[model samples]
Target: MPSRRAVLAGISTGALTSLTGCVSTKRTGATPGTDSNTDWPMFGADRMRSGYAPSAAAPRSSPTERFTASLEGTPIGQPIIADGTVLQSTWYGIEAFDAVSGELLWRFRDEEPGDTAVQYQPPAVHDGVAYVGTESGLVALDVESGDEQWRIETASRVSAPPVAGYDWHHLYIGTIEGELLEVSLEDRASSSPGTVRWKRSVYGEIVRLVAPNIAGVTAGTTGGEVYMVYDGRGLWRTKVPGGVTAMTAEQGNSLYVATFGGGVLKLRTAAHAGRVSWHTEVGPVAQGLLVRAAGAVYGADGGGLTKLGTDGGRERWTFAEAASTIPAAAGDTLYIGGTDSILAYKLSGGTGVAGARIDPQRWQYTHDGGYASGVSIADGAVFAAVGDEPRLLAVE
Candidate 1:
């Protein structure tokens, strides 16, 4: 890909004012979602922040032939697994459900009935602290204790979960106004909010205003700028191009970035964006959702699971098992959620999909939704959320 853009042109102070000014109105639209079980709290399940859920969930049937409910909405966000329960968020507040039984556990509707709304992304939980994001900002609730912690307006909209780790746990996110922020989650977690850790622009010069998707923050900036500041150690502000959305596929020091229009770009995360490792065309995938395992890279691009050969982004296999859901993995199996069905697959080879096992009917038959932004494996079953409805789903 081309090198990062030259120094960012002058950004008028007015733009910042308008962006900050608009933040107040962001809250007027958030849905009030809450959780019942605190075990598998937060977006990634634990504070170490890995998007994997753990629970001894039994699939309805071996090689399940069909899905079960009419839950409604798509799987645009990842689901959290906890105490045999699943938690998810959508345009509504947080919704909790029984993972194995597929039962609604609790719903937190913080929004007023007449309020206009935008989709609020999933939140993260640690030590019982639940963190949910909205168009207005980030809100904190105690999962086990059942209490509100602190609510901070961080953006016109937050499309990703607040990532936590290190002594100074931080909330990483993007805004509709086109900016990136890293706030200290340590504050809310500890009941003491701190100053904004660091803020960066993603437009003009090295930054390209990027509004992340529900998958979370996976960005690669320009001018050799490459950042993935989950914790303080991985914190970097280098330069690369190909604006980053929530979707990211990384292995070792390499970060595979996808864009909304341009396509997937490979960035070397040497903490120095001065070099371009390689470039390949994966189309302008709306989400560059991917994970690496056993020397292979799997992602949800276009509308399926793509198994690629790492060296140059060559396709080894493609499975349209579920459309658009960020593919998740457990052991040797991969889970996919689609508009109407949720599917699972075990790699058969390096040339095309080997085989697929799908739930013939919609797992939650209520609505034809499955943005499957993220997935997790715990105990044995898989946990994910459906889109729109923000219903938590657990399909064994």
Candidate 2:
């Protein structure tokens, strides 16, 4: 097989066409639940929700489609990689597929004989299990068998993506009613698998939650509140200019926030106090997304995408295209899911073009339907789920 660079070089001269048939490969006995160091196992790529895949070997030039598979339902969020399987949560259920050949592995649904469970957030995989937030509460399913291991019901609906840490056997989840609940997954091997460790009310709808490798949790609320909590106690709370739509943390100390009111703010939270380190109005919108990678922070919304320096929040570059979801980064290329396609941009600018509105457009993959979720990179494949016409495409 040709190297990824060689493959790109072979097709760099022109736009690639949409793949006609799905690709299939023989199974290699790789278990979907087995954790791999390079896997994009959750949203934002880690417990910190930084959306950076440092170890992944991504494309250096234009990429071509590796496979495409139709999904059972519309995907709710970005698809994640678990071991060698691609997992996507949809309105009807969750579907798992072979990442290499786009083969169907298994399906897990909350529907029972007479009742159906509704979920709105993506799942986080840890220790051979997938944890998801549903309207009722938290649900844990075995990654290999798609079996329900256990569940814990909460007072409100969990509407935000979950974060799982390897350091502890606990899963952190956010609800629509401003509750941050930590559920212990230590008893996952038993018949009764989960227990709510603690819950804290941030007094507003919890929009996002990050469980850093450190000893605390950081939450962003839709009511413009950012809270730092440790051991179920509020350590510090501060207000931002607008409702927090997205947040990314750098090593658990520097928290970068994107707001609906149109700005990005960096907060210093190392000493259990929330202090604004720097703030800038660089085009972040009401439904913004942030990714901390390549020594810079990328913020995107419906309007466009902006790149800012991490040291002092300096504006680096701006792409005047609507970004519908969080961007992903690997190596020197940044991938953004746009209104009608997945666009790639170079992190470094050309000489004599410092802070130029121009970004070297690296590659573009256009789909008939718009993107339903953000782009995810794993195992040399870029996975994107499409909207209206539900399907998942793997580009290499």
Instruction: List per-prediction Cα lDDT, in the order shown.
Output: 0.49, 0.74
Highest TM-score scorer: 2
List candidate 1 stretches off by more than 4 Å.
1-75, 187-195, 204-243, 246-251, 283-288, 348-374, 387-391
Q: For candidate 2, lDDT tens digit of each residue in 1-396?
A: 764234444542232332213222112221222112367888888888878776677665677888888887787777888877888878767888888899888887766635554655778887788887777788888887778888888888887888875475677888889989877777565323487778898878898888764577889988999998888999899899888888888775788888886488889886848799998876466253477776678867765667787888887666665375767876666787877788877655321122332225777777766764777878876788876678888887
lDDT of 1 at 34: 26
Error of 2 at 319 (Å): 0.9
TM-score of each: 0.67, 0.84
Give per-residue CA lDDT, model 1, range 95-144, as digits (tens).
66656666665665566767765566666655556667666777776664
lDDT value, candidate 1, whole model: 0.49
